[model samples]
Target: MTTSATTETRTAAREEAEGHLRALVGSDDAVLRDDQWSAIEALAVDARRALVVQRTGWGKSAVYFVATLLLRSHGAGPTVIVSPLLALMRNQIAAAERAGIRAVTINSTNIEQWQPINDAINAGEVDVLLVSPERLNNPGFRDEVMPRLAATCGLLVVDEAHCISDWGHDFRPDYRRIRTLLDTLPTGIPVLATTATANARVTDDVAEQLGRDVLVLRGSLDRESLRLGVVRLKTAEMRLAWLADHLAEQPGSGIVYCLTVAATQEVAAYLRDRGHEVAAYSGQTDTTERQALEQALVDGRVKALIATSALGMGFDASLGFVINLGAPQSPVAYYQQVGRAGRGTDDATVVLLPQLEDRDIWAYFASLAFPPEQLVRQTLEVLGDAPGAMSTVALETYVELSRNRLETLLKVLDVDGAVRRVQGGWVATGQPWSYDAERYARVAEARQREQDAMLAYLDSTECRMRFLREQLDDPEAVDCGRCDNCGGLTLSTTVSDAAVAEAGEALSRPGVAIEPRKLWPTALANLGLDLKGKIATGPAAGRAIARLTDLGHGQALRALFRAGAEDGPVPDPLKSALLTVMKDWSRDWDERPVAIVGVESSTRPQLVGDLATGLSRVMQIPIVGRFAIVDPSIEPGRGAANSAQRVAAVQRRYDLMADVPAGPVLLVDDLVVSGWTLTVAGVALREAGASAVLPLTLGTQT
Candidate 1:
């Protein structure tokens, strides 16, 4: 074909592509941005790699969707999209169908559908496949499906690609597996990485990982519709009051972001009590329930979904507002979340209720970073010596790390070529692995800097959007002319006294349940403990005065139980609160406890004894002697430790004293953490003639 003829054909193809994009968006006048077209051309015309670092709601999804269609038309295989959240995957599936493309997802929530989905993909029945980043490491998918997909996939897209960079605010270890995927892809296949939250460092890291000679398209990161403001609340109660008072008056239905699951539940319940239609969306929310809640928010059936970061990334609601109960640790994360608002609307309210406790929360999160080299080496040795692949549950028996931290470490090792993720679980590759202590330390320092930056964002008198954009390294950032600082702080910080009182009551009234352990730790025998299988009969489902993470009583309880705090007897206020708990608890008991038994505590003996003594006096129950520690030298250790070590530490350390009173007895302790102490103590009491054991504690740690 002549050059003029080829030019005419290319122009016609672009016009037709634009037509399909317009139809996909349901807008006759829809037009593609220049950068969007550039990304599309790179993926479709040249089959090259591209990274698009644009603001949220900037049609990043459109670029990939449009490219998928163009590639498929040219007889390309299905597009593979590795998304980070189930909510985002669901929205993408819906959007793909609207664009006359078939999209499916294989996620944790849909185990039963995997076989058929796999079959459909093999049969060329799926145009696009949306999967979680963790799916890349799943035994069946990684070993069986991924190899085929990598060979034949026409386009590979990584949404929320910032997660692939450890320097990013919300770094996820599973996303590191994407680099391996990219390595195995054929030379000519197109690859796309998209994120709205990447800074210069994260962008460089992700783009470098994408490949050589990659197209890096970055645009301004300012949100025109977001009106940012910070509401400085003196206490948690005031923050709750502010959200409850102003939620309805906001532009429309949106999210109320909480820092922790406990806070999410508390805020959601408080809003419900205040006659607002709301639901709690958190990591603990069931998959089906999360879907339902997401739909509720999308349909405007609920005014807000009180959520943790769990409700973030791909929870598409053209929300009118995004209210945060506490500031996030990183301005980048704050920008990503607030981007959820004002997507479809011309203007959306974005408010931050900054509390003094948010910094501590950030510290707690930072503490979960990559473990030290000793633990990593220990895990490697354990896996290296194992007879066969051990499941994560079984592997926990041989390691001292928590499940989450251990899993994260294993993923990092897998990416570093020190471990191989196999069908059953994991195996050490025996690779020469050197722990990058300097890199880990540098990442920790970066996180601290981000936390400091977040505090600055909260306190800055300059434009809030400008501050965020600058943090994201957006070069075109300027005064947005919309934020409270750029304009004026128009949001009222005043909260009604009645609302504050109600919030205070909700925060103060605490009866968080301390559910009993029904099963022994999976491999207690390996730990040299005789425990195995079901915990035949353990402490009855118990209640606490409050959770350590509770919004209302949590702060006080957390301070009271903080490390190095002087241990003392239960205070008068807590004693009175325990009485109220007992009274309310009595109303629901089928059989009232006739005796009280104390769990021996070396660290807080006086506190535990006084609490048991006070409960016995108020309930008119006799003291059924304390369970004494059999080995004073064996420390029970911190409650925050893993289940295996925790259970093993206290398994045989307690023995019920002789001549204990009979009948149902209340087991009193200063706190219930892993519940192993209660379990072992209850077993001793049962053997010593108590007919039943009822547990009561001052507080419960989640």
Candidate 2:
């Protein structure tokens, strides 16, 4: 075709795209931007693969929604959108309705709707169908639903496309499944991938995976309406006090990001007590509650939602402010979160309240990177030797990694073709697999560099927006004259004495309940241990002074457990905190403990002994007996050890060397990590004539 003819054709497509945009946004005045039309033309006109790298609120969704309408109007099949989060799926479905598009979703939350939804798609009654990456690998979906959908898919949309690139901040294993499905797609079917957080490297990585001739439309990552600032507070108490004193003065309802779930609960509870209308959200929250909390924020019914990373991405709200209780590990991730605010509003506040302990949290997360090659081999060997497919619970008896980590590794291996996932569980394939140690090392080093960049962001004397954009490799990064460093306005650091006192009191209020284990880990007999089914002699629910990830006594507890720290008796603060736990705990207890028994600790013996002695003195209970280590070599100290391994490590390694009192035995230890050691010891004590066992510890891991 001639250039003139091609230009005429593109002009007509742009005019048609504008009409679709108006319907999508419910506005007669709405029109498509030049780049938005280009993306739509690539899919609707040329039928090509394209990766769009743009900032938040940049109409990335408009391109797809419009493209879907054009394709469906042209007698194409339904558009399949592989979304990553529930919040994103909900947001997409709502947008589809505005465009008069019939949208349906298949996710874990709405399992009952799957069959009906698939049936509607078959009847050509649905315009768009959304499914999460994790759902793509489901047996029913992968074998029955996904294949049929992919074969006739009109357009494939990968939302949050950065997830497929390991270089991206939020890379996920389940996303790798998309790469496999992409290879099987029918020719001439268009694919569109969109994200706001990918850097230059990540952009290239995703483009290469899409196809060789993929079109790349990249844009600036700078957010003009967001005024960025960093407020370096010395402690959690000071940060909380500052927020309490200044929350109402900030912009409209916003989100307060916390690094840990325990921090979210603590901060949300403290603010609520101070009369702030806030809610806590994390992965631990149920699906129903998460939806309600999200709606509350969107409707402006609450002041803010104290949340972890679970709410960091895909949430749509024109928030007035985005406050971080602590700094994120990387600047890329930080930008994605703060981008949620100031999208629709003309001006918004984005502040970071950094503390000294943030690096410790970063280190903790860094430790959960991909496991070593040796462990991967062991997992494969176990699957190979099994007579049938093995579930994650059964595999835990042979693998040392934690359940979450193990499951993620298995998914990655499945994608690598080293294992096959069937109806029941997983079976090893005879295919040879090689571990990419260099790739793992490179990713780790890249993460460290990202951490260093984030630290630079905290103390830099340049424009905050420019600093962030440059980190994302955005060429348009320049002095925006809109952040704290660019002479823009910022929130005050002044905290009142009363507010500080209130915050301090809240932090000092301690005690996290430790629920006892109800069922034994499956397949313990495979490891030479006689344990399975329900745990009949398990200890009753207990209380800890705090969680290691807490915002209160946790700081001190973390220091006490740090490497090379001195082994001493309980600190005055923790001891006093323990007294508070005792007072509050007694109100609900049926009877007080008659004796205290210390669980043998191979790492922190002195800490365990002192904890036991102090609790015994405070309760006026005698120190009747202690467990002795019979097999000193049976050390279960790896932070990565799973439940079954922990139980086996303590099964017969310790013996009750002391006579017990008649009543309940208060089991004391330095920490309760997996709670397996306490369970083993409590079972032994119960068999030795103790009526009941109550487990207590200084700190519990969440």
Model 1 lDDT per residue over 639-663, tens place? 2347887777675566777465667
Error of 1 at 265 (Å): 1.6
The lDDT per prediction is: 0.86, 0.89
Tell me the lDDT of candidate 2.
Answer: 0.89
Clashing pairs in 2: none
> TM-score, each model?
0.97, 0.98
Give the runs in model 1 whose Cα sits over 4 Å from its true position. 1-10, 638-640
lDDT per residue, candidate 2, 206-254, as tens digits? 9999974698999988788999998877877899999999888888889
Evaluate residue 580 in candidate 1 and report its C-alpha lDDT on the 0 to 100 scale. Answer: 77
Q: Least lDDT summed over 10 consecutive residues: which range in candidate 1? A: 1-10
